[model samples]
Target chain A: MAGKQQQRLPREVRERQMIDAAVRVFSQVGYHTASVEEIAGAAGISKPMVYIYLGSKERLFTACIHREADRVVETVRAAVHPDEPPELGLWSGLRVFFRFVADNRDSWTVLYQHARTQGEPFAKEVRAARNRVIAEITAMVVAGTRMPGGERIVSERDAEILARIAIGAADSLSDWLLEHPDESPDSLVDRVTDLALVGVERYNTGDLPPS
Target chain B: MAGKQQQRLPREVRERQMIDAAVRVFSQVGYHTASVEEIAGAAGISKPMVYIYLGSKERLFTACIHREADRVVETVRAAVHPDEPPELGLWSGLRVFFRFVADNRDSWTVLYQHARTQGEPFAKEVRAARNRVIAEITAMVVAGTRMPGGERIVSERDAEILARIAIGAADSLSDWLLEHPDESPDSLVDRVTDLALVGVERYNTGDLPPS
Candidate 1:
């Protein structure tokens, strides 16, 4: 902005603003081109404060990755009930996943787009968050495959692959959602859940092709 | 090593070198930090030659995307026969997709990773590549769902969603393959096709859960 107007804000609030600005800049120009000065300017603070508050660019990016990943993991983790039907659990998890992406496009970009591709510092952090979510989904999937008396149909390994496919579908759909803003999470929840679970069930039953 | 060594090569050979250098640099440092000079240096040529041969970094990146995208599409398209059973077509296509990524890791990174994340100059090009392949797979999916007399079990739209799921699975698995280098493409082709096609079959054959 014009001449980096010094807004006298509390340290906590200022840090939030800096992080928010960094998300926008990093999402827009990506990690390499996004400068601390530009982020500070966008936050209406000085460059030194960005360094003081968030440390180096590497640290700033790491901060963004951690923050966004935590929010996504928290949002998704809080939504599903392990006790419910597994497909239902997947439906809830996917509903939250898409809702989270729709609401936080910048964070989505930061987490899914920019951060994953930024090499080691961001890669390790992003992968940890991803593996955690995938594991949770895998558990829900395993739960879902149980019959009325709790007889397991799909194997754990098969369930894990199905869970990853569902996650990948949601991830790709989330990217598609960015392009088509009006699409709602509820609409997608049914389509994706139906498409994925139907296939999983068929696989669990007699759907495997002649071997 | 000391000075810029001029490789007086043919236009075709020089362009190939430049694109190879680009794939390495862009994958290493990412699009924003990957400079034209760095690409030229990696190619063992000077800056102006890179410009003359590839036009601009933007064009060079576009070239890389097209080249890699073309290679992937050609490989997969050549592998799967449309007249074959749809699931088998999918199996063959995925086998080639994973094998291509395994053999050409840098090209895989450039096409799948860097090309997608870099904004609009590359977005349209990358999206075109993705949509083209998705469309091809969608057709194979539609073909796979045909009945004995050619009546279809899965509708066109349903097949498209399933195709996207399969593509998403392959994309995610390709990323997984990066971490597990020893894993064979054949092993994954079996698993992914089983998970995806079985679900589609159940969905088509009235395998819906009791309401």
Candidate 2:
């Protein structure tokens, strides 16, 4: 019966289980501190099985990073509605990003901290993912600037800078949220979105009127 | 006379040499990748002497962090004249920060990336040093808002967020500059400060005019 039950689960299911276990271990102990034995134990399998399924530790880590980053990008992309104004789309995207991070803190840590330091290929993978998001943000800013009767304010170069600045603000706030785990993700998102949009609103407005 | 010829240098001089060596090693290889032997070798000293002088690798890291943080804070603080308006103060401080990162990229990387990841004590050390700089920024933001007779704009909480955003943007840009090494520090500072100040100025203006 045990052999039949093990056979019933597909290879994909087992692979996911291994990846989940790898993410948890990598996030908790970081890449170097984490070991194959611990990950296998966490996955409820033998070390040899992990090697067989994932090929190697480095491969396993790469797999985890790909999955986590894809999850984040998909969630953020799904939150944006094509018909919606750029501001609303961006706000929704930011909300999704915060909620994703809050729900999957471990996965986010694995992708951002662990993968970033594992050397070239993995770092490039993560950077490509980040750049994709940044590019989408740049597009949104460029679109948002074309409101009817509104003067063309920020140049493309400045718009790119604005997108990076927005991402930076959100990333920093997320880091702050990580330290203060007691804070609810909803309230944190509200504060972060407001602060971020306020900066955007400021950028759209060319001059500061005399107070 | 021959036996007494080998005299140890003064403690301060030796400490500086150790820190300089440490910054080079830590920034190059990261925390876990660097070894005490490498540090001592870089300093042209015996491993035993490094241990005797700086205690352990951990203590030596702490000392290096303190020294760099102090230099960063002092440089920014000295750049601004207190009598200048808050906006100018912030601009000058930003300029100083950019120049400092340009001149001492290694020191900045060691403090920001390597020390930040090692654990709580070192992270706290960096955070404390960072908050001191952030607090000064917060003060400037609060003061700048008061000039316009605007409705209590830029709250203490928002000011803190802004400070984090500003510093994070600078740090991310500095990291970006690592890849684009040909970019001049002055041009980078000019562009970033322009983006930041425009955001600040727009906030003081009551309405978010779509421009």
Location of the lowest summed lDDT over 10 successive residues in candidate 1 chain B: B1-10
DockQ per candidate, 2 decimals: 0.21, 0.22
Candidate 1 per-residue lDDT, tens place, B1-211, comes to: 3233344446668888888888888878877788999999999999998888888988988988887888889999999887776666777887889999999886677666766654566767877887898899778878776778988767776676667767877787787777777677777666766655554544456653412
Interface RMSD of each: 4.4, 5.8
C-alpha lDDT of all candidate models, in order: 0.76, 0.74
State the local distance difference test value for candidate 1: 0.76
* Residue-by-residue lDDT tens digits, candidate 1, A106-145: 7677656766554567777877888888888888878766
lDDT of 2 by residue, B132-186 (tens): 8889888877766554556645677667767777777766666666556777777
Docking class of 2: incorrect
